[model samples]
Target: MSDVNTTRASAPQWRDLRETVQRNCDIADARYAGNDTLCTYLLKMREFYRWERGLPYSMALDRREVGDWVVAREQHWEGLEAQDLDALTLGERRFDPFDHEAVNQHLSPHGLVYGAGYGRGARPLFFLGSLIKLEDYEGYRIYVVGQEMARDLSSPPAMSRGERIFVRRESIRRMVFEMIEAWQMRGAPAVDSLGRALRAYGHDPGNDESLERMVDAEVESAVWHEVGEVLAGRLLGPEWQERMMTVAGSRAERVMRAVRDHLADCLATLPALLDDAPEGALHFYFANLGGMRALLFPQLREAYEGWVKGGTLEELKRLIAPAREHWLTVAERLLREPPETWPVSDEALPSLCPDFSGRRLG
Candidate 1:
């Protein structure tokens, strides 16, 4: 892995990079942590604590210790909330935190992969990690990272900016582990799609080794979704970002994201997985589906059931066939409205895009 890391005598540079990334992450977290419900906030903090302490998934967290840490972390965030994001300084050069391409140009040679981008609610997120893999994908540079030195509460497994995609193997592993842990915590009922997926893989979620195996396979799943994002970006055109600005931080923005996510999956993600991914991967996708996405396309879930019962993928494929066009129509319809027409409500759903199933689309 010489190509992955040229980290011979770069300790000082590494420290500087970590400091900058962590600081930006703190500032962003301080500002947005209040947006989550108490349950979500605590769950996210638990993961953040585990990562910061470098705890193994098999180890049980001490509840009292975790509670104390959470209180301290929240206090720390209070101090950082008003702080402005800082630029990165490496030796004699300085770079804007969001200019990841230019920043990576210098950091890659030092075995660093840096990510800076906006996530849900337009909150800025930043992380620094050791570069694991770097390659070209359809004219985009894809950087896969492992062992993050710094990160925010929500370490999104993948992010795309312009044409660059950053895939975090470490983050993906943790998220997959969390999924299994959550299922196991609930006694893994048969009705859970994740439970079915785990059975299909012969995965024992209680066993960390098996969980890692699932992580290895699902990393490919995360990459496919990001590629689908690029594909969706092409179809939505650049105006989609402009549209996002109009609804940012509102319920309507969530709807907007859910619409694009469905479109992207139909265009690229589900197709790629159905063609080559393991049986469990498809189930895993549906299991993770929730929030606005699950609401916007309930028929896809029915299509999934049809596939499972009939032992054929044609039902799923047929549903996906019209998804791209259908979602685009909805997206464009939303775009046509004056920005003043929002904050959109449930009533806006039928007016802008009527609920339609695959049967109706056909």
Candidate 2:
């Protein structure tokens, strides 16, 4: 229950985790007995994480004994509410899974969830003694079970459930790497030109609201690292890594400023992504890129078709030339005459996102 972000580089050590679970389970078993839904939920959730990471979920507990106790005392079982879970009863001042606040305080930093997906009074008879072995990909199998538990803790209809975005960790990592490589291959001069265009188009680098909107913290970290590296090369020459690691004061600040400035342009040059910006300067530049792509990627699609089929970047520049021209045209117009609104109308959206209907960058 420490700050997960601070320790994200290391996953929880299993031996320590196992011991904690055993001690907690013994206390719950001694007192709560058959109605220990909270303890059961925690054990299963922890096991699910282990399953995802391809680790063993074994524990030193007798499942059959626990199952019999639950079945025999079924009539007296009572599901807990958030407040009921938060209260300490046995004078032990220990962490409990029933304590929704305590659990979320620990779990939120890791993007793990509990007590938010379900409504109260919906606890099912989940005796963990049955799950001795988990199959490969059992993480997906148990995800539904977790979802149902979440539903039980869900708020009433009057309260709005916030929008949730889930990106597969691997896919985002791929995207980050692809983007970095693509920028690097484009060469430093071209990258610098694009950065200048972003400044001319009034793009601001200080804004990072989009970073917060991304669902996964690891993806955000990777994006920052890769983008920083890409800009570092352009701004600080071949010895950028040495400069970044060893230098400080004004030198470092200058490099960071240049990187942020270049990032503004680089981001705008790419096909406008789905959630590129929230408001202010970036919103229109992004829309313009999308519009440019809408106008250009299709026309160049046929020429690039051979490259895609053959899996070669040999002719990528030939394809990018037209797209870059179109992008600059839009960037110039945006600089000269700003639009009243973005994503225009459906009829006008094509001007920003030529393949708006398809919504697929490829």
Q: lDDT of each structure?
A: 0.82, 0.31
Q: Candidate 2: lDDT of 346?
A: 42
lDDT of 1: 0.82
Please provide, for model 2 over 4-94, each residue's C-alpha lDDT reduced to its tens digit, 9 standing for 90 to 100. Answer: 2222212342233333433333333333333336765544333333333334222333466545544543332232211123222222345
Off-target runs (Cα >4 Å) in candidate 2 are 1-296, 308-315, 328-339, 353-362
Best by TM-score: 1
State the lDDT at 106 in candidate 1.
82
Positional deviation of residue 185's Cα in model 2 after best superposition, in angstroms: 34
Against the hidden true structure, what lDDT does model 2 obtain?
0.31
